[model samples]
Target chain A: MIVTVTPNPSVDEIYWVDRLKIGKETQEEYLTRATDSDISAGGKGINISIFLARMGLENIAMGFVGGYTGHVVVRALRDEGVTTNFVWMGSGETRINLTVLEHGREHIPILIDGPGIAVAEGEMNRFMRRYRRMLKVADWVVLAGSLPPQVNLAFYYELAKLAKQAGVKVAISAGASCLTHCLPAAPNIVKPDTREHLSFEWMKLGTKEEIISAGKRIVQDGVEIMIVSHEVTGDIVITRDSIWEINARVQTTQFRNLVGADDALLGGVIYQIYNGAGIEQALRFGLAAGIVSAESREKVCRDMGKIEREMANVTLNRI
Target chain B: MKVGEIMTRDVTSVEKDIPVKELIFILDSAKMSNMPVVDEEGKLIAFISEKDIIKAALPGYFEMLHSTSFIPDMNQFAKKLGQIADDPVERHMHSDVICVEVDDDDLQAADLIIRKNLKSLPVIDAERRLVGVVKRIDLLHHLL
Candidate 1:
């Protein structure tokens, strides 16, 4: 079974409007009706858990939740058949992130930051105890997403270390210091979260060569697989023996929603790997799943036939 | 209204193998009087409640009847609690659980709760996976 840890889970509220206009200088009251709307449990690891569950995989999502928003997150996951093991914080509610998508400009989404969470020491201890117990039965443990405020920067490092000791494969998807501190644990898979920035530590990920070099450095540092995003439609996968570039043939205009596409890609790869697929095949399937998710209205596409068809559009080349 | 519309979606559940001590802690922390027990695949299998814990701690009906002047004491309750704290919840959970499907009419859940004197009814999907729960209060609120 796979176990996903989302330190700061959120209830994502997405609205698709015909047009969105921000009034900067003029002060006027304007109303815009949403053509479509949806709310779901979100956070990198939570999305991965939902994606895996959609494929009929046994996975558990662990995190901290509180108040009414937290209840929404749990309820949504339960409805999707994702088992959850969340620690209810003593104070404060779980954050809610809002995304506004304009009808014609679906590629450019307006993202809103959610409230930061402050996890108490007691809550951290409770989460650790539950996490340790879950590690015993987990074959793969994904420590993803950003750290909550007041949480130690080495939180993922500690979790990866524990999972390693339990003989479970660890996959880390994080950014900034959270990712930097956990590299020592040598997680099996490392996908640098590039939403906030395009750099991993000192290495700039502006060009293909830079991304490939950075990926190789990470792989040499003990990560079995390092997947670095080279562009919106491509990723560089570097292992000890091989380096491959995975490219999706689909155009940006074909994407209806790119909110959870990255998570879907990671989830697809993990699912394939868990089912005994080789890294190349897994990456191919993963890219296909990501393309399917991006082109559909759903955050993560679960249609196996569609993903299989999309696989024909994914091309992998040795770097 | 459909049961899915009125049911409480945020229902807390547990597996059958959960320790009684952990079960009690969940019950107390969640402020839930009862919890549905599901299998690994999320199939509803049994139900455990505060009443069941109390029944386990107290003397049985036969024992009470046999002794005319039997009195319950803290020591007896404590000893019984200790004995069962580490035991799996399946030993005390009621296997015959009354439930409603998510697509069923809300009145069906209300009827079951009222007729069975139950606090809530576990709502399941077509595949019998525990999805949500319909409580006595939820029905009453929907009535208004």
Candidate 2:
């Protein structure tokens, strides 16, 4: 079983509008055509769950959720048949990420910082107990995305350690502090997107050699697989033994949505790894999911068959 | 004719490890006597009902009392169950639930519900992951 942890998930409100041009009406209102609006659950871990399920893999999404919107997010995942184990907060509500995408235009995303998490000492203890229990059932455990303000980023480090101790493979998709702390814990897989890698002071990933060196540094820290994806240059998968560059077969579609494609990439890799595929094949599958996700309006992947067909274009070269 | 065509897609369910106390709100608000307990894949691991909650909660009293007596207000009994709110429903839920596949005939689902005296039946896939639910009322609304 693949178990995922999302600390700060959200309910997203996506509005499809004609244009982004502001009118004199407060300059703050982005009017939606009522029928052009959709709401879905967001967060890296939840996206992983959706992508895995679409690929016919079983996954569980767990983390902290609260308030009315939390219920909505939970129900949405359940409706998608992704099992959830979110711990409810007593007071604060989950955040809502409002996105405005005009036809044939770039999306403007305004993210509201959701409820401030002040997990009581007792609550932390209880949540940890439950988290450990979940790790036991996992063949692979995924720690993904940003954490709530009140949470210590070291929590991921502890979780990775626990999963390793339990003999479960660990994959991490977080950035900055969480990644920094967990790197020494040496998860089996570390998938960090462009922005996340750019956050590092030493990571000047402009050249191909620089990016490969950066990935090697991470692998040397004990991570078995380090995957860094760039929208323009494609994906690089680095391991202790070898480095593989996988090409993305991105097709031009009038309708496009770019968000969460990287998460889908990680999802594909995990799905392949769960099925015991080799590193080269896994990277190709990962790129296939990313390419298909760009063609979908929803952040999650929609077409598994299309992804499979596109896999042929995902050429891999051992560098 | 298939269960997928008529089964309610928005089915309410609970996780196996959830506290039985949590069911009070879901069961009471939804007016549901029972709900399926699902695992990570949305597979039907078990089913929990009001009777299961009460049975799991009243174990202490059952062992203490030997003689039969008149019952008090139902609310009082519920109040007593609240004391063991931390107890997991996994201890009480029916693990071996009779479920219908989504592609199964609606007649087969209705007949199973009747034969087994079930309130509703879980609609699953070939993998046994829950897909929907077919309540008795759904059958009534369709046939009658």
Candidate 3:
């Protein structure tokens, strides 16, 4: 079974529109939407769990939630057949991120910060306590998304270290603060997007070679698997012995939602690994899962059959 | 909604070896009447409550009479409270503790708390490790 930790999760409200324009003063130019809207539970780890559960994997989603909105997030995950053990640790409602996606236009996202999580100290302890117990049953633990205001880099570092001590595999897709700290703990896998790699001076450009060598050095420092997912050049997966590049060909329609694709990719990798598949197979399977979600314009992959069919289109080159 | 949906996740717990004096300070500081006790590996083994401490502090005659009328002096009560300084939490804690799972329904949790007369229901995952707690107040807060 897999366990995912999303420190800060939210209820995302996506609005579809033909055109979206922001006006300085209550004007008619901004009055565009009437097409459709949907709300879903969100957070990088929760998204990954959605894909993992869709792949017939047993997994649990854990995080901090509060107020009525928090309840909605939990209910959303539960309704989707995703087991949840989220901690009701703080006061106030969880955040709701509003996204306006216009046809043939840029996606406009207005994010709201969540509740301050008043008892940050106590909740951090509670989260770790729960995480340790869950790690006992977990084959892979994915730590993803932004940390809540109170949860800092040290928390993720401690969690990754705890998971390692339990002999559980860990795949982390977090931001600079958490990811940089976790690298020293040597997570089983680290998936930092191309933009995140720019933070490191050596990986400023984020080229395929630069990222691969950096991923290799991370292996030397203790990371077992390093995956640098680039927006333009595609994904590069590396281990100490070999480098694998799996970028599948899939036709994306005019409407697309890239919000959950990264999580889908990591979920696919974890899914293949949990089933005892080799790196080559895992990469191919992971890329296909990513494509399946990206092309569907949904936060989760609704069809495992489609991913399986697209598996043949995935190209894994050894470098 | 399940008991877990409204449970307080930041539970204050004490280890078995915790000194009673320190335990008292913990409970007082947290304004709590009872807390769950866990072993080194963090499995719920017992529970300690204000009632247990009072029981431990009471004179032996009180047990036979089941009454506190004999202790007529307020000074005697102060002396009885001092008895808590000696033993560790494990020595005074109730060995049998009941816990609820995260998936348990709110109604079942309410029933357990009512039947057992628990101030707070300790919530545990499948592994029997403490996760959070559902306090009596938490339930009342929601119901009222």
Candidate 4:
């Protein structure tokens, strides 16, 4: 079973409008809210966890939560039938992330990074112990997305190391510091988008070839797979033996928004892996789902039948 | 029965001289299984399938592979890109064609497409210069 751990989580609030104005109050004429709205559950790993649950994978989401906002996140996960175990801090409210869309363009204009949860050393130790125990049982562990400040970059690396020791496959999606540091540790997969790639000084040249070469360099550092994502160019996967390019399937389906495609793709990969598909198949299934998510925006994952059919249409012949 | 009602006027067709990569991108963007290849004079020359692009761009065309993590090796993926590319539309295009005039009955066009399980049929003027192509899906939608 796949297990995802997010150090930070927030409620994702998406607002759709005809046009968005700066420094002006906007009225909601027609607003649609998701079934669950926990602002504190808005991290990459959390997104993937919810998607895995939707895909019918038996998985657990472990993280830290606090206050009323944290409670909302936990409640939503439970309602969604996602087995969640979040370490509760005695202080602070979880943050809320607001996504505003206008004229088919969506922007995360405001993200309230929730108040920091104060955890005593003992409490942190307890959470880590439990997290380590979970790692023991995890077939695949996804250390997802950004962390709230005060969380150490090495924290996820520790988890990855422990997961490796337990013979569990690990996937990490994080910022440059974390991704850069974790490369030597050799997580199975590392997802770094264009912005994250910008921090790599070696990529100053900024050609597609340079960017992919940098990714290949990261793979040489021991990462089994390097998922380098760019907005216009789509996402590319670099492995020791192969370099595959999957263009986002934007034109095929009518687009609603483009927020959760990455998380949805991660979930697809986890789901296919749980179903015993090979790495190649798992990646394809993940990309197919991701493409659908891009089209379905607001909708978390694509309809499974549509995903499968799209996957079928995507023929991946090696060169 | 109206052929105009069922024919697609804003259809996307590739020039015979277009690169295979551009053709693949168009087919992908259009979400179409096949596209009508046309010459500079906008005359139908060939039809290219997704399968054909995949085979041309990818080596080892016979091996059974899964959908995910499938990356075609770019170095080995030599596609004769433009004019001199080995897989030109003229060399590979199906020139033997079933076609219809714009004045033909829509039902007749639909019947021919359904019977043949064709994706599209070239529409011609009295002089047979390309005008529009009737698509199977468009015909089926009219029936609905």
Best by lDDT: 1
Model 3, total clashes: 0
Chain B TM-score of model 2, please? 0.84
Q: Clashing pairs in model 4? A: A9-A40, A10-A39, A10-A40, A10-A41, A10-A42, A11-A38, A11-A39, A11-A40, A280-B68, A284-B68
A1-319: candidate 2 lDDT, tens digit per residue: 8888888888877776665555574557564462277788888888888889788786778877776787788878766767666666655777877766666653233334354456556446546765776675679998988888778878899999999999999999977556877887899998764554464556666577877898899899899998877544278788999988888655444335556777888999999989999888788888888777766777877787887887987888898
The residue ranges of model 1 lying beyond 4 angstroms of the native Cα positions read: A23-26, B1-31, B34-144
**DockQ for each model:** 0.09, 0.11, 0.07, 0.01
lDDT by residue for model 4 over A1-319, one digit each (tens)?
6788877777776655665555446454644443332232567887888788777675678777766777677667655556665666645666776655554443232233343455556446646755765664579999987776576778888888888888999999877767777776789888864434455644541556765788778888888877766543155677889887765444532555556677887678767867888878987888888777766655467378878877864445332
Predicted structure with the largest DockQ when compared to the true one: 2
Give the alpha carbon lDDT tens digit for every residue of B1-144 in model 2: 999767765435777777877766556644568988877555678888887777765645665776536345465566668776877878778988888999999999999999999989988888787666888988998788
Off by over 4 Å in 3: A23-29, A105-119, A195-197, B1-144
- The lDDT, on a scale of 0 to 1, for candidate 4 is 0.66
lDDT of 1 by residue, A230-315 (tens): 77788999999999999988788888888888999999999999999999889998988888998888889989889889999999
Report RMSD (Å) for each prediction in the order shown: 7.7, 6.2, 7.2, 25.5
Give lDDT tens digits, candidate 3, residues B55-134.
Answer: 87777677687566766766655686786676788889988788888888889889998998889988987878766788
Q: Clash pairs of candidate 1?
A: none
lDDT of 2 at A233: 27
TM-score of each: 0.75, 0.72, 0.70, 0.61
Better of 1 and 4 by lDDT: 1
